[model samples]
Target: MASTDDNGVAGYDILRAPGASGGTFTQVGTSTTTSFSDTGLTPSTTYRYQVRARDAAGNTSPVSNTAELTTQPGPSSGTCTTVPTVQTQWGTGYVIQPLTITNTGTSTITGWTATFTLPAGHTLSGSWNGTATVSGQTVTIRNVSHNGTLAPGASTTSVGFQATRPNGNTALPSGYTCA
Candidate 1:
């Protein structure tokens, strides 16, 4: 956002409109920088952005040129792995902590799921930032609305879960497959 007037631009208000021009405009964020990186966007989706410049005197300029962008699909050859670490533990209960899902390929990963095993004696009791479902020893964790998009070489730390550990086994989850 260039200086809209002689007073110089103080900040920027970014608005995004879904689909085409007729859609409703929603203010995305306010930033002092010239560029913004939006995450958690669905792959193969299109969005329209309109930028407005705000002066030091609190005056706003007319909407600038609209920029349209379409996100590319996830990598066909990309690799994603969920690495779990221990955060805390107690009697008959333990936490899987927050796991980092890293995208090792050259393309962005969208709408991801972290698959792992909970071991025989552990059962999921609570979870956050994702949804977890267990079938036998296999656990499938899906990303929430946010934190779903992982850029190339990007690592997102998410999916902390509390599970009942009845067998006193403190080992981390295994079979960490992410997609």
Candidate 2:
């Protein structure tokens, strides 16, 4: 497996078998701090691994002390769970309500779709990167793609939206909780 370290430098690989030759190796995934994935191997076969480190200056460090493990039978599957909480704030205006979504989950979030529905009597004046639809008294912003994966503890900010309501009333969206 190839991995990236905390500084975003990306030149690391793990040799899964020390004495075994010609084992196919490939990168699984990358993030700021870590990368991991299961590789295809013979069931019940013992494998050794050695991790090597690299720096931005093109300098490579010695491989880590070798470690050993045995591959289990068949392919393994795992689930990525959503973070329990997200941080949010209300901007000054409907058009300026900037929402920041964070991923506090144990696994990386490959993407996120956020939907915001404006309250009654409100219409969306402008929005960025989000599709806005007005139906009756509700204005819905849907499927705003953040474009990049949000790693654990990572946050991304959505573009602002302008909203107009009667009598200068601030229109807050219902069911606007983030997590």
Candidate 3:
């Protein structure tokens, strides 16, 4: 799309929502041509996108229609791993000792997230050092700004959470995956 021939159209600005539900859009890139490519995004995560034409004078046209896509899942092997330790427990509640995030790859990592599923009847009561989200039995934990970014062979033990489960249940979480 073009605006009045102020300088003609020079490029397009690309915007993306941080999540799948289109919460909000922020400029993620600029493309001088008709196409753009975004890289280094998290795998299996949904994103919403929009583009607007820009003039040489830096004026922008109305945003184009929204486009949404979900990236394919990353490979099973990643640069990092998250391990939880049990600190304490009671009849119906337990504290997961701080989680340790370790970078096993050769390069520094900007951020990381871990996913796992709790046993039936378990619910997260709270967390620290990381943001936690629970859906049914699945939990997703993401590094906070201050704790992210790790160099090769580095490790951080700042993430943890507490949860409640059925009294006397001995089951623990399984299927841990971090990337």
Judging by lDDT against the true structure, name the best candidate.
3
lDDT of 3 by residue, 6-61 (tens): 58888889999977674889999999999899999999999999999899877789
TM-score against truth, every candidate: 0.55, 0.40, 0.59
Candidate 1 RMSD computed on C-alpha atoms after optimal superposition onto the true structure: 13.4
Best by TM-score: 3
Q: Show pairs that collide, candidate 3.
A: none
lDDT of each: 0.81, 0.53, 0.87
lDDT of 1: 0.81
- Candidates by lDDT, descending order: 3, 1, 2
Model 2 C-alpha lDDT per residue in residues 71-120, reported as the tens digit of each score: 66532121222221222323444444455556656676655545556677
The per-prediction tally of clashing pairs is 0, 4, 0
Single out the weakest 10-residue window by summed lDDT for candidate 3.
73-82
Error of 2 at 18 (Å): 37
